[model samples]
Target: MDQTTSWGILAALAALIGGFLWEGGHWEGLIEKTALLIVFGGTFAAVAVSYPASRLRQIPESLKTVFRPAAPDVPARIDELVELATIARREGVLALENKIADHPDAFIRNGLQIVVDGTDPELSRQILEFEIDAVEQRMENQSKIFESAGGYAPTMGIIGTVMGLIHVLSNLADPGSLGPAIAVAFTATLYGVASANILYLPVASKIRIRAADSVQFMEMMLEGILAIQAGENPALVRKKLTAFMHTEEMSFARKKEESEDGTETEQTQTKRA
Candidate 1:
């Protein structure tokens, strides 16, 4: 489960409950099924009207992303790339032909296959970057789908609230019913605000984060592939690949120090020569 998504939902619920309690509220007489049905139904209807059928089907999966984010294994995969490159350099790229089919990651596997076929590094980079860009564009659209729903949610909520008020106001001749009717009318607004904040906005934000991470990781893969094709040493490749894992502050600092030391050593050797 995605910790952020789970924690976000839990926190939202906690805050709502705490706020209610702090306001001397009780659960009794607060059940507003009509309000819920109207707001939720209206919001979804509006969304359906706005988005295409394929995107409509994806709503559930998008929501699931909030709690079930796919783990980004790109950083760890860098080491595997280093190993594969070393093997290719030692035994020749042809030796990797059989293993290409066995690679679970289609991206790395395809790149290896292309390398074995003696594809130009420039061509390979272009193709791979194109594929990555396509994927990113698709993700962007999905994120926007949720964001679009968020834009509609609050307005739909208000629409529901208005509908409820219309019914309530028409029956104002009955003085005893005003309190219950007014409470029910307000529930739609509450539902709208809550769903927008807890669900739509957060999902969009998570998608954006996921998109950025994915793009960075793919760019790192591109670098590694090019380095492999250029016959760079595996250890040097590993050091370079560490740049993709800038999420680790310690790794960034270590890489910086190592780079500085490597330059110093090169300068010293040149002076001695």
Candidate 2:
């Protein structure tokens, strides 16, 4: 599970709720079933109408992606690619064929298959690049689904508020109910804005980030495959792929270095003692 995404959502809700309570607002004021039904139900209906049935079918998977993002292990992939490059350099490109079955990622496997088949390098790169583009486009479309929901949610909330007002206006003879009715009407607006910012828009942004990371990882693999097919040295292959490591991976590398340094220092002191 993506703890950052999960904790971020919880923190946002806690801040909002805590601030409201601090301001002497009652929790009951935020609980309007009619407003919730209108904003959420209407937002869903709008999103369903906006996207195709096939796209709609992916909502569950999309939601899961936002909550449980699959981050690629960049260092591990680099090591694997360097190993493959070494194997190809020593034993020939055909050696990769045996390793392809053991590979987990289809992208890496396909790239290796092309190399093992003696496909022209330029054509292989084009095919792999095209696949990467298609995957990116598909992920972009999926993110847009949530983006569309974010766009529509606030408008739906306004519509719900308007509808509530109309009902309140129609029953204006009950002066005692005016305050509560107005509060209920405004709850729809709160729901719409909060859900859009907290859920839909954030999910879209997370998906986009994941898509970019995935593309970078695939590109690194493609580069490794091409390098191996061209018989690049394993050290050079490792050098090229390390460029794909993001800041987080760099930080991890730094921490690992520090740990090793500490271990070496402790061993030296122990030897002296």
Q: Any runs in candidate 2 off by more than 4 Å, and if so which?
A: 251-273
- Alpha carbon lDDT of residue 138, candidate 2? 83
Expressed as tens digits, the lDDT of each residue in 1-273 for candidate 2 is 989999999999999999999999999998999999999999999999999999988878887878887778888888788889999999999888899998889999899999999999999999999999998988899999999999999998999999999999999898999999998999999999999999999999998988898898899899999999999988788778877888878777556547756998999999999
Query: What's model 1's TM-score?
Result: 0.87
lDDT of 1 by residue, 36-114 (tens): 7877787778878888998778667766655677766654677687887798779877777887888877777878778
Compared with the true structure, all predictions reach lDDT values of 0.79, 0.90
User: Residue 112 in candidate 1 has what lDDT?
Assistant: 78
Model 1 pairs in collision: none
Question: How many clashes show up per model?
Answer: 0, 0
The deviation in Å at residue 110 for candidate 2 is 0.3
